[model samples]
Target: MGFPSLYGGLTCLDFANTVDGRALPEPEEHLHDYADLVRWAAYADLLDTETAHHLALLAKARPQAAAASYTAALRLREATFRLCAAPPAANDLALIQQGYAEAMSTATLTPAGTHYTWTLAGDHLDRAWWPAAVSAVELLTTDRLARVKVCASSGGCDGLFLDISKNGSRRWCDMGTCGVEAKISRQTARRRAARRTTP
Candidate 1:
């Protein structure tokens, strides 16, 4: 589930609009980058999370939906980015919380309670963005503790994965990139050793 797809940056906004035919606002152009994903993730309200979760369900049920879920799945990119970024940004919670205030409500970002939470406008219910938004929150707060693995090449030049190992040490989303590079590097070292021995 960690490969590039045609709909790379479509986003939660795109997923909800595309599936339900209800357009809100488009995510910023650079949303594909990991940082934007982080903002999107924390920005998700309950409505949107549930929507995304159901979409994930749809993708699981209807294989063809995989094409679209690529963009859909990038929301998960938000959770992943949060996991990595939260540590560094932990001290900056006040500013982080300030930015999260939604237009309809000014829910304070506790930012230090070991979890994140927010309340969005109830009007978006029919929009039903809850599923996607909620799922993203769950991942950030409680769900993130679970183990996951993401693979990449020596320079992170390939696909990624969602490995859920118990010990949490799983790496390389796919062997094609990180796995192959390691193998090739080892082989090259071995050949170089053999040449020196023969001389």
Candidate 2:
């Protein structure tokens, strides 16, 4: 009933999925406002508890700034979506690179466990989208492109996901929803065909 996170595995690319079925009159838009964005950040592990609380307070205090952050987040998501959906043209790649550069400019590397991780300081609007942007850039530049997949459900689900299965056969964003529905649909079709062919 709440905002769906079925495709959160893809981080920023998942944000592109907030609004689905573009042709429908009422598309499923998860990021209705700044609060929704924070909810998504929590799901993505982009915001720690302290930063998230501060951001929520900031949103309440400066609604306009919050709106701008939401808009910027959407733009970065779109750029990531396009890059993942296909091989980007020169212009498309340039736009995504520009976004990645901007995000990296505000982030600092901090040692976490045994590896270094990007961390942003304070609760600026920039921080709202920084982690997600960094994640998108990481996925794009790494060797994971071969495993990036768009949902193959016939119900027109446009969820983007990473196919990390052994056989690389992962087709649905979540097996419980679109995958189950598609399986049921296939079984029903087979039964109908069998009945029609019976003597």
Candidate 3:
């Protein structure tokens, strides 16, 4: 019900993981509504508390607009997942391009200690997903894109993450959850095989 752990190591990838069990028949959806989207933006540090509150109130006031924004967010999230974890599709890339353009149109170049960063301005409903769009574009354009990976748990997690391991051997999204489950499953399989052979 609550947002999945931020194991993706990137805000955009985490946003993609807002759905659990992407490989399952029916994945679990965490962002059920516009308010949930705002809360997720806040959780992902994409929005300040005040800005999140403002957006939540704005969503309530403009329900139809908020619904449209939510639909766009979901579109961006799926496009990000495909672009990061599979062979890039032209349509997916186009969606990301449109999202990035829209996000950048409203972004301001703000000073951040030593350098400037593109900060989304205003409390528009799309504020919840603008940073995600920007982040997806940034990651896709960088060499770090090589580090993006999909979960390898045999239980079929299908979560996306940036594998920052020294040898790039990380296979699971979380060592404590998917990793453990896979390890246990393998051990059980081995034990069963051993039993069958012994008999």
Candidate 4:
């Protein structure tokens, strides 16, 4: 299947949300293999199409290395999710720290419109998650971290997202799915209660 819709607002949060219903008994995993990681990286705009295709080919040639990189990426994704959605552990912080350090070691500050941004040098296998590591660190250190929220959907969606709403009242990850499902559930319950009372 294709990757889930990007509703996390930030790349790091979006990365964390690759697994749906994280708190549920059986979570849905989107990234199945190295190709999935490459596809997701491209979809997330972490890598251009050309770079993504190169990585996919490289992964095919070096299956072991690609599997290792995919494992590390999943570790980073889980660490990021815990850090953002709950009180993080020391190991989570350490993993994120290592990821951020690795990313920065290869990053160079490049001029943007009015400021500079760190750009990764080459299209390494691990490059897929480098920007997400940097983003996670930047987000954790900022006040906007307070805006981070877990989806409030009762259907057990544990997706993480940045709630940039003005009033901070944002609840569901996506209004179309979780929000609509919740509304229908509540309505059905109300109707059931009304029928019980009438009879």
Candidate 5:
């Protein structure tokens, strides 16, 4: 989906990568490729989607639920950057920014009491998704207030949080574990499977 949707996806994990805590290098400090952070952020969005659904339902009843909706979306963006900040190429950044903004543009705040409950009332859904545009500012900002993940220009490999150690000197998700296993598995699996199918 779009980045606004993608950003919401990251909130699922609440930005907690390690079950435990030690000195860890920041995600923005490494992982220069958008693929790394974007993928992880997208993974996080899967979790956020559920939370957003429940929250949206609650907002239907609760008067102050607008804040919750906004907060949840805000968190999604934060966590995505926390784990996978990368500097996208100019074209990629523009694409992501525009798409997310466009998606959010149709969002509307159904007046509740004091603060309006957000809803898709404009056009994001009519053609594709207009009603869900409440999440647009969640992707961008509201009343001029916005917070988003700024892609970095340099960093280490993907999932580096899992790679850093007790001393926190490591980079990459795992040089000894996932990094090597992936290579070995790819090399062995193809050869073995190819032989089994060979004449």
Candidate 6:
């Protein structure tokens, strides 16, 4: 339907979260089409409403370019997941480094409120994917990596989150979805175990 909630906290990580699981064969991808991708980008603050509308139209006019951009986004998304989900090996590290290099190449240092910020440049079809790429790089190169966590919910929700909690014990990608689901599941299991023990 509409863009999903920003459960992953950061735009880039949220982009990686367009899918649900890590198991092979078929993770639940939310970006079915270019429009979906653009909508998700807009939700992530990578595209303004006006720019998103223009990009959506551009995607319709130039399907091939749109498809290419979609593919690039997915590749970066996977690379980001690999970087965060576990201790990346040489290849995984290289993929992330390449993604970061690409993002940095297109970025320019600009003044924000009181500090400088990296802003993406270019009016290309793939520009929509840069912000998320930059965010992925930022997360990877910071101390925040210690806070990154995969969801603990069972049944393969497979969401990731930056646990910004004070104690860093925050679990579940979303209390409404995975959180509630896990609670219900634990309760059901306890009930079943009780029944088994009872005559």
Per-residue accuracy of model 6 over 1-199 as CA lDDT, tens digit each: 7655889888767887888766535777788877788888777778887778888888889999999888877777777887888555567656656766877887789999989987775456677777777677788789998898898877676688999999998889999988998899999999999999999
Per-prediction CA RMSD (Å): 12.9, 2.4, 1.5, 1.5, 15.4, 2.5
Error of 2 at 56 (Å): 1.8
| lDDT for 68 (candidate 1) | 38
Error of 3 at 8 (Å): 0.4
Off by over 4 Å in 1: 1-82, 85-87, 90-133, 143-146, 149-152, 157-161, 166-169
How far in Å is the alpha carbon of 48 misplaced in model 3? 1.0
lDDT, each prediction: 0.38, 0.76, 0.90, 0.89, 0.35, 0.79
Of models 3 and 6, which has the larger TM-score? 3
Task: Give one digit per residue, the lDDT tens place, for model 4 in 1-199.
Answer: 7788999999999999999888789999999988898889888888988888888888888899999999999999989998888767779988888999998999889999999988885567888788889889999899989999999998889888899999999999999988899899999999999999995
Off by over 4 Å in 3: 87-89
lDDT tens readout by residue for model 2, 1-199: 2667656476666666776753356666777777888877776677888888999998999999899888877777767777777555566556566767877777789999999987776568667677666677778788887688888888777778888899999998889988899999999999999999999
Instruction: Give one digit per residue, the lDDT tens place, for model 5 in 158-184.
Output: 331321134634433434554566667
Best by lDDT: 3
lDDT for model 1 comes to 0.38
Task: Give Cα distance to truth, residue 183, candidate 3, Å.
Answer: 0.9
How far in Å is the alpha carbon of 172 misplaced in model 4?
0.6
Q: Global CA lDDT of candidate 5, please? A: 0.35
Q: Model 6 shows how many backbone clashes? A: 0
Between candidates 2 and 5, name the one with more favorable TM-score.
Answer: 2
> Per-residue alpha-carbon lDDT of model 3 for 1-199, expressed as tens digits?
4789999999899999999998898989999988899998888888898999899889889999999999999989989998887666679988988989988888889999999987887667898898889989899899989999999987778999999999999999999999999999999999999999995
- State the local distance difference test value for candidate 3: 0.90
Q: What are the runs in model 5 whose C-alpha is more than 4 Å off?
A: 1-83, 112-114, 121-199
* Poorest 10 consecutive residues by lDDT, candidate 2: 19-28
Please identify model 2 stretches exceeding 4 Å from their true place: 6-8, 21-26, 86-92
